[model samples]
Target: MPDNGDLRGVESTPRRDAQVRVFAMPPSDNATPTQIVQGFLEALTSDDPQYKTARMYLTPRAAENWQPERSTTVLADGPDAAARAPVQDDDEHVAFTLTGREVATVDAQQAFSPSSGEYNKLLRLIRDAETRQWRIDIVPQGVVMGQSDFERNYMSVNKFYFASNTAGATRNEPPMAVADPVYVRSHVDPTTQMVRSLLAGPTTWLDPVVRSSFPTGTALAKGAGSLTPDDRGRLVVPLNGKAAEVGTGRCEEMAAQLLFTVRSPTPAVEEVELRSGDKELCSLAQESAEAVATRGSLHSPEYLYFLDEDQRAVRIAAGSDDTEPEPVPGALGEGEKQLRSVAVAWDEHTAAGVAVDGKSLYVGSLVSGGSLGEPVLRSTGKTEADRLTAPSWDARGGLWVADRNPAAPRLLLLEEGAGEPMEVRTPGLDGRIQSVRVAADGVRIALVVEKGDRRSLLIGRIERSRPDGGTAERSPVTVLELRSAAPELEQVTAMSWTGDSRLVVVGREKGGVEQMRYVEVDGSTPDIQQPAALTGVKAVTASPDDKVPLVAYSVDGIVRLPSASQWQKITKGTAPVYPG
Candidate 1:
């Protein structure tokens, strides 16, 4: 794909969203004003790394002023610039107005935030006397393309960081790696770009809840051009002197952060080596990197649990279909209490259950001979409809639930699933919460708030503050800055944090059929990629390991949908759930 001289096609990263790769060609000789504008827009959508071809249609002054890396504004449809109005008195000047409907924007830090509005801008073109060719005299600062082009040109990747507030986090208990998702150019050097983004720190929205191990002023070495894996599958990164000052433990953490951030694109990389000048700071292998961040380090659940026909909690093998359902070895599973809904802990050693009346919340061990404890938290609502919703457990041994009492609605949290229930302050919440799902990272919590007749899904960041210089265990908690995660769904019936930054939601539009789809926490992009439709879906749950089958309680009773397979009714059960 190159001509005979020194010129050649640029190196490329694999395309994650599409199979075809599109290239942009330079402007033709003596192109018309409209053609110049159109050609430039086409170049913006191609795989040109730094947009060199796109700038060829711009004037020398405009080219230097344009900053394509500043941001990318995605529209519902590609911009229209065919209509041109010629300028009077200046025979060589003409202007075109670009118009489209804005959908979302990716900032310089690669954070995608959803937006909506009319997009309109004017571009003026002038014919150069020397070359007698038309070129754009004024250009927009950033790239603008349709949603389709945005997907084609970019891919999403999660940058790993440690949770800042979960103090007692361990490898298997509380998830340590917080996934800060960002968009990167699909055809660029994405691995190297991801490393730079990791060093730059988390995005504005996620910075308050997560922290990077890399110290301040730390950056890549002066000129480590185009990092790639060697034949032995080791990719070495050279960092600046600022990063070289960290100790051994922090250096390994930096390596783990780099390893996970680039794993999506460079899965073949067996090891990552960090260097400062010629000295090796530290080396970490992919096999043992989980010691630093434990998210996705463990296997999927071995059994799926639910309530059986007799209203007793039961369990079945997660990998087999012929296995008969049996009552679990816990108090909740012992037919001692009738449960209306349930939640299991991350380790599968404990579980929380809501009574049939939904006012009492109980915790019990799943081991044989273990007993059920008294109600950890209870609601005093008059009726079952106004009682507590299902309970949720955080990664750090914390249990969360919301009481929908019309008089004193509250979101309660228990440390280690015991002791006095602490009321978590919700600053921006204006409606009564009906559901609760805390992310494994423990930095985010999802709530279904009900106002009048509408139920909306909102994601809020959890902030832990020490007012009087208290210990790690005494950090006061608050859930503020709540943002809508599914603004289009008229009613979000149920949802779960299926992945790091993604949620599987069951919702409906205005007088439309109920649908199941996936939504990101930002609530900016539409959920075009979704799951198959299931009817009478009462609740849906997915494992933290995200690789397991989806289990839901619906009209078909308890059903499981394996990867690339149709949903099958495995047993006649209700309130099915995999351990959180």
Candidate 2:
């Protein structure tokens, strides 16, 4: 028990008659942090029910001090002090402050009055009137105790009153009942804790006052079991056995009953069996030879190649048990006259070949000495020359050849049975011709123009026929500007036309990465889709079918279209299609 004599001086004051009442309860040995704070709140506010009126008795200096582990003391002494003190009687008031080991006394006239706003702001400090038994305000000196590490050593002074027959009487008494003793546990201040109650056993023991205050049998109803921390800070339950598993997976049978408690339901575990008996369930064995063979033959064609040569073409057709190329006698240019090179025409009937002389252009016939007909020969209107670049016949049987001459670099479109060869002039194309390919539509021809050190692939369309009716006028149009796209090309070795007028030019890019860019000539921005970044890509040509664009390099031959996936190796060594 506290010394009641310490408050005796204030009780005998002239202006006010006061009595100090004190009550002390033994602390429970197993009392939690929450229970201690809750018990304190209930003991303080047992008499005063309205919290708003109860706040007026607290002084401002006491409320402002919040130092942890240190005791705060407020001496109520100043002008208007009597008005700020708690009213004890009709003609008397009382003033008090907490000090070291004692609650000190003061004259009512010397007390200070806090502002109305300040008094109302102190309402939150009440916490829960029904749970925590105490409502406290710390004095200035007491605030330091809360600021220290040993704050639990200090006890808060909470004021309370009891109803009496006398005009003013102060007697501290524990409330008749403390409801819902749950405290908001914080390490900072014990007075600011919340209040909660734990189940003593499986059943509830309600206070008689609460039972009578409400309807009959209301207090006897079973209350919910709350999750609370035990002595070791591990969360445990007040109830044992299956009742302890309310929110856990073991309570699956009670799922439907507590459906509303499904906010954070426990997770379920799925069991998987790896083995059943002693026999191997999932074995790790070396793959059998037969199984490897089945997997290898699953793909349609392991290797695909183009039989460009006549002799090799016959062999590839006979070697494969799969579908073979139809043997149309007049389908492809045939017969042996020492065929040096063969280029597939964009259209079927018009394949052009060159002999060992490299001058005369053979269109649709490989007979020597004009055995089949008059062969299209290259001439500068000076002499009929034999040495020539690759030859290609257009859809109208007009033979187009790239003549090797700097002074008169010409792309001739000559008539097969005509009297003299006609010159098809392309302005701004005076350089030597490296390669040429007629477009699939047969209206335009793609040419690789070499001027000095620079090389460009130009698409030339046959604009008009010659005035003498001997050759067509070929005007060169810049489809892909090689200087802008690939500036480091020493020479454009090969060119091919993909469908939709997209020219796929294979040449050396800036960093020496062999590049292939598909450029659309129909006035759209060129989409430079580099299929593969490879080296030594010498020549590229699209299949006449256009459905499959086959790209043939020096090392790897016959690459497919769409995805440009690599095909089986054709030649063992790297050799040019027409080797010197």
Candidate 3:
């Protein structure tokens, strides 16, 4: 810790875009009104504790009323704090127009959402009667900055939630962990802020589908703010009395949520101890958290599956030696089904295969002597190109695929990879369906829609309507709120879900070379370094487990990129995949 109290608690992480540290400078001895505004804006972008330097430039009344923690407005470039004409009514007053193109906003709850619009805010500066110097008398609530500044100051972290498991007591199956990502200050007690965000409940978009284990009105114990792990990497969280009421099982669930939500905090946390009003409730180690819920969560140290040159399903041990790929034990692997692409279920017991002609979708088990059943789905498109896209499976036994018949494009969902197929409504979709991939959480789906020469990558939210006594004929499921995830790319060739809120995309910019990168589901580009560019990436697949290597199907055959390693040829196979 530093001698300066303000710098003591803050970590010394360099800015994302810069090599050197960038700290907020306090108002100068005799700063002008414009200087005060500019300095204040810059300070808002800094990781200063509660924007203390920014408050110094504001009038006492303004500073007292200002709330920088309420929300954050991010712009394309930055606010243009240009000096406007002076106020004619008062000689001591001057007005400035702070203008910028709004790109997105982070609400008080820390949920980041994409937005677009013209921004116009008025800031009034008044000459202080005592100091005879300019001070901002009026300002907007919350902070505002450029996107780049936001990226440098804030990082995205996921808050865990359990699926709306209404079947409470059966114990037949545990609810899965749902990841809800939000942005928080990079170094300003992120562990504490993440806990607060979790206590505040989920973001609006995810609120309906996910459930928090915390009791209603549950909050941190009074005055238990700014939590940090001790030298032993143990974090003790003191919660309100509401948390103490739960039993051992539920308390462990609450601790699991905390362990995951606070894992991003630096100086890593190994264990989390939950306490309520001076009494320790429960303690959970970080590794043990996943077992309580995410057992079938596409776990790591799993094999990578793909179709070889013979159009047979094969797999190689992920993150392992560069050995030759072997055939998977299944009818699709042994039988002469002649498949184009395939999707292995999360449990790895069943699989879905798209035929070589791309007109049929077949399903079967993955054990020895597992026989392929009749085609579960058969597209009627005249040509193979207009048939079914690659099959994708969700954690909740939902299989998704898009039919690009052109005449009647449809997004279909098969329940448990069996029975009658349900047509998933595409409400805000544009053009014909090109490809579809459902996320592991099953709350979001990624699609590549081709309207013309341009192929766009869009992210759609899954909404299961299921009205009372609804039948398969009714519009029970729909993919809504279609928004571009990669508007900068001209043509999207392929993509795969890399994690809870991130995707690995293979695409080319307008007239640019083909490249591979990652983009957040909120349509924001993360600050982490992207994978090295690969050429002719026809398809891509990534694991929910970060330790598993990223595999891709390219013109040069199948290749895998391990963490911090150069691309290595795994084998000559196409449509490489991990348990989805």
Candidate 4:
């Protein structure tokens, strides 16, 4: 139906401003005040360094005082509602109010944390007498951007810190390093930004539980710019000469920290070489660093365990050789005691469970003919919803449980034997904890809390306090510093700590479907991988090792992902569990 096969007018008309490139356009001599403000906002989305060109929209005096690095405020879409037409009072004066919801904030130190509430930024514009163009005169101290622009402009990288490797660490376990997540500019070399954030210190949330082996005040040697590796895949990091004061053991530890942190974003780096000025101080190969710096390395379990239709614990062989489900020889596995949830120890030597009746927690050995111990913990909840949650065991052999009894909710830690369970206080907790999963480091606990009918995921740091009196004083007591870790997620149903600082959680955004995704403990961003394909998931479990596939319970049966080519059904199971 086109004349002369032209077909020029077949489509509908495009938007008037569709071809306009706001970021590329500078203020014309006759540009209005609002146009200048819009241009400035668009320029912020560019990858330009120091925002030199963007500064051209501002008066020289305002440009000299405005500091974008002081803070960053993230806003939602439809920034038009936040923008206003400038009201001019005089030839040189105009003002407008820019409003938005502050989703997150990046401080001057580059630490990213969740922040909420409506922010109203006052914009004062002035007409330059010389150029006869509108320029930003007085603005908020920080930069404001919409969510889409924020995601495209900023990225996240994790800095590594080590557990204390000093004299008191348990001999059975190799030294381990934990990850601290931070946000930085996506255009800049993340390797250098990550290293700089590493030197600055851990975010306040993780500062208590993690420690950096790099000595205090340690920094990149003066004159060094970005981090880059040599032809041999060796990343050479130049530290200020102050590092020379530490001994060889300390140097290796510091190298391990750098090796893990740098290799995270730059997988091409095979080894890390630490230097003071021009002198090489130490070097650590990836293999050697893995022994000391890695956490949650993959080690397949002897069997993939879950609860069968009979509410009994059962096991199926893990790895290539898939086997039919079989009940273990222990009492808990025999179905005499009904169970609602279960947890297994890393050694596969012990198992813990919550009774179906919702009042008792039992711990027993997994070995054949092993007797089920007496109920080590009992819940005081009066309702089914208030009953005991799933129990978890830390690497140190301590069992943890949350009794969501509305009358007396508490998080209790039970020792291996029949020792009295100590109540772990979660300070700053404003709601009842529905579930708790302790990290392998034994210093962080992932909790699902219910506040005002909404469930939120939280990370709490476990701190120990010793008696001040004598060497033979009372046993140390553990306390929790609880904080909201995932403000972006509105309703979190179930969660599992998969790595040092990553959690795979089943949650839904406002008015969205319930789905599973990997989120950092700091809640700065989601994992790069798209949320895994899963449906009808009632509960999910994953091994501490990230390489292993995740296990989940759906209406069909128990299923393992990517491990069996598809969601292979294991059996009619309820709760699938793995060692922490």
Candidate 5:
């Protein structure tokens, strides 16, 4: 057991690495109030580290106080709709307002969440009597970018952390790597920015579950402003005086963390060295880091489990080397009752299923001769839409389900046995949750929310706050920082977590055909091997490990993405899944 820290995950490849192109029309020598406001908004989408060009449109005082990191407002549409207000009592003063539906927001510390409502960016401009130039007099402290620009200008990067080595764990359960996604400038040297972000520590959402090997207040060694790999592809990160306190072994762990986080498909770093001033404290090669690294997840399930044409649960190994599909041993395999969807527990000892009628949920043992026990939960809604969509199990043995009943739509959590179910509170949610999948870490919840005609994929943070007495609470707590995880999809039909920070989704773009692709929990698409063509995909499931093959239930039958380029049929099945 290593005395390092809790594990974190990172995907082998980024979602997208396109260079960010900002079309900021250079400000004219003499700009008007409206032109200055428009130009400033455009510059917000650029990869400017210090908004120097943008500051030109604002007064000296306003520029001094303007903090681009204060917050990020995501507008639903482009900024062309900006409306200039009518003349006021003073001709020198003018105002412009940009109105659109707010989709999400990033706080000062870079926490992202889903948001809605009429979002307005108000800019009060005034004419400088002496300079004859108009400047922004009053404005918010953050930048506002349209959705298109948001996708184009920003990219998601995962900073790695280690898993907690618990007591009495099994031989197969070594500490693994975990990935926490953070957005950074796409055009910047990602190697440098990623290293800096890693040094800053994990984001708010990931702080509680994961731990970093770097000591508190640890930073790049003094005089080191950026990180770069040497001629031999070895990244040398200089730490400040704070690193001097770390011992040899601890410093090696820190080097391992850096080695894994900095290496990617591009910029392929071969080794990492931790330094204090001119002295090298610890170093790790990429191969050594992989010995204890998860890369993205801990489990790599071999068999893809699903329900057959007879609605009986069955299992099929993912690779082409496997034989025919085999029936699971539990009661579901016996087909006593019809089921709509099913989820296997992480230990593969139990299975949760929703009845064909979509009204009742059942739990049964996976061992041979195990019986499909009675329904553990039943929907109280009056219609079929109110029935359970699918079941998901967490590492802690908790089963999650969503009741889409219009009268009482809700997300519920049930203990392993007949424990009472608890309802999770979702604030600022404007639609009915169609499906839900809980991550292994037990902190983030992936949801397929249906609002009117649009079905969107959202990620919500599970908040479990203690009461005033500091006693543990039982009921499902609240969900905060709900944000769009797949904003580009026209409609998200089904999704499953492929890695700690990655999800494989079946969705279609506006006016496009339905397809399967990989997306980050932060709503950014990764550069994945495009899976083989899958049409009429009813459900898709993949092991959290990227090496594991992705299985899907399409109109034709059950198929798997053996390689990035193509999909092959294995057997006939529906609602495929893996042990959570």
Candidate 6:
């Protein structure tokens, strides 16, 4: 364990086990107040003081009913004498007078430095006066200490009770009255001090609740029913409809319920079987299954356009829609290919979709191939490359395609009515383009490039007046450094922009944990905030207003976070889908 530093010791003296009796009387009119006060003074000066003169006798008791060992450093002359001689006059005594008589006498143990000793003497006087014998025998039941103001008001009370009998008292003498019990829950990610959720029970049950003291980024789940750790050590919460999936990490037991929406199944039905990596997971219902795309429009609602069992091209619109559904378009003609991935322009005016037919990208000894003769966006005839690796839409309604066959990947810019696309070169971007996003203003473009497993983010400015009609000027903004000794983050799964222009990156860490991070474009250190543990995260899209992010996890259903505080379940019945 790392050394944090030495522990601090308590300033007061330790507790002791010896029991001592002291006495005092209730003041009355007939008996002069001075007479009552004189009684207390005489008790302290008696042949033997009933209470111990050591400072340890004045320290508060511990909760476990155990007294701390008495300190050996008690003042030689005692706290009273050492505390006041320097400030006291020859004829003046350091004492308290009740009415006109000195009921309690105090002495400074150390004359030169009296503050510490004076405090100790004052404490003893108060203790002795409170526990003194009453005209009625009120036993010295307990000793209570408090702030100076609290002590003043408390001492004015006409009655006293045994502190140990209080419902919440942890010790014989409680400083204050018992208070109502309250439950506090907080979720924090240690890596990034981002507070995923904090809630006080009963009022904020729907908010994510994380345990205090647990490592940051720890996943938590709370609901109406009880949560128990499963055989696999994962925390499981069973809902009314089905079992809800929770992120994995340290689990804390708490009392709170997260609100979730439960929905009835739709009427549409079409069963189509599919295979992923040779494993049969579930049968897809072409007609019945609905695809809802977030941040998408009617023209291009499908961020992920897939062919249903009926060979239909279905587009799922983004956002919440209550409109009546319509039949999806049948698969494109034999000459037209299926789109594997698509990218839309920042202005949403243009888009480029890519499909591969009968070709494969080599990765070690693994041979991966897509459908052959797939209809992909026409590429610029800059090089005689046969296939397009990834395609994106530029700001000016133009399409850019990356030809990956050649060692040097070429960028082709295609215009609306161009017969042959124009090839454009960007300085300082030597790696293969993996993903791209157009800036908010449509004049700047951000690209994610990869060299082997290492990735780097590069930004480029579009120049229309260049000699070649269009030019891309590489900017100095380098968003992410994928190559680090800490841990290698795998494939870039999703990217979105917050309202403030900070880029959010979602990917898998070396341990296969789905992680989310943010990097400000204005040049600041990256803040990587870990979300709940997830197996396979297929799609991550932000709301148009950037207030919420809807993440679709494979086999875990859809999780919706309206804000950091509101985690809602938006889907029911259907299991999460995993892509090949």
lDDT tens digits by residue: candidate 1, 262-379:
8866787888999998899999999888765577334477788889887778988875674379988878888888999888888788888999998899999888887776898888
How does each model score on lDDT?
A: 0.85, 0.34, 0.84, 0.76, 0.76, 0.31
- Give the Cα-based TM-score of candidate 1 against the true structure: 0.91
Top TM-score prediction, candidate number = 1
Mark the regions of model 1 whose C-alpha exceeds 4 Å error after superposition.
Answer: 1-19, 82-90, 129-132, 169-175, 296-299, 468-473, 524-529
lDDT of 5 by residue, 218-313 (tens): 877656766678788888888888887788767877887777677642356888888887788988887676554444365667567888888888
Error of 3 at 17 (Å): 14
The residue-by-residue lDDT of candidate 4 on 366-466, one tens digit each, is 77777776788887777888989888877667888889999899888875524788787677888898888988766678999999968999888777665
C-alpha lDDT (0 to 100) for residue 79 of candidate 5: 58
Clash pairs, candidate 3, are: none
Position 358, candidate 2: lDDT: 57
Off by over 4 Å in 4: 1-31, 81-90, 129-133, 164-168, 297-302, 319-323, 328-331, 334-336, 416-418, 468-481, 486-490, 509-512, 525-527, 563-566
TM of each candidate vs. truth: 0.91, 0.37, 0.90, 0.88, 0.74, 0.35
Model 6 spans with C-alpha error above 4 angstroms: 1-313, 321-336, 344-351, 356-387, 417-419, 468-493, 498-500, 508-512, 522-533, 551-562, 565-580
Best by lDDT: 1
For every candidate, C-alpha RMSD to the true structure in Å: 6.3, 37.6, 5.8, 6.8, 9.1, 27.1
Candidate 3 residue lDDT tens string, 1-580: 4466453364686654543346799888767777888988999988786888889889999999999999999999989987687445345888898999999999988878778888889898888888887889889999999988988788899888876732322555656777888999985778888898899999887787778889999999999978989998899999988888898888888888888788865537999999998788999997787666662234673688899888999888878876598888988889559999999888788889999999999998888887886899999999999999999998777788889998888999998899889888888788887888887777778899999899999988787765647554543787787888888889999998876678999999998989999998877787777997788889889887766778898888998898887877777888988887
Which of the predicted structures, 3 or 6, would earn the higher lDDT when compared with the native? Answer: 3
Score residue 191 of candidate 5 by CA lDDT. 74
Model 3, global lDDT: 0.84
- Global fold similarity of model 5 (TM-score): 0.74
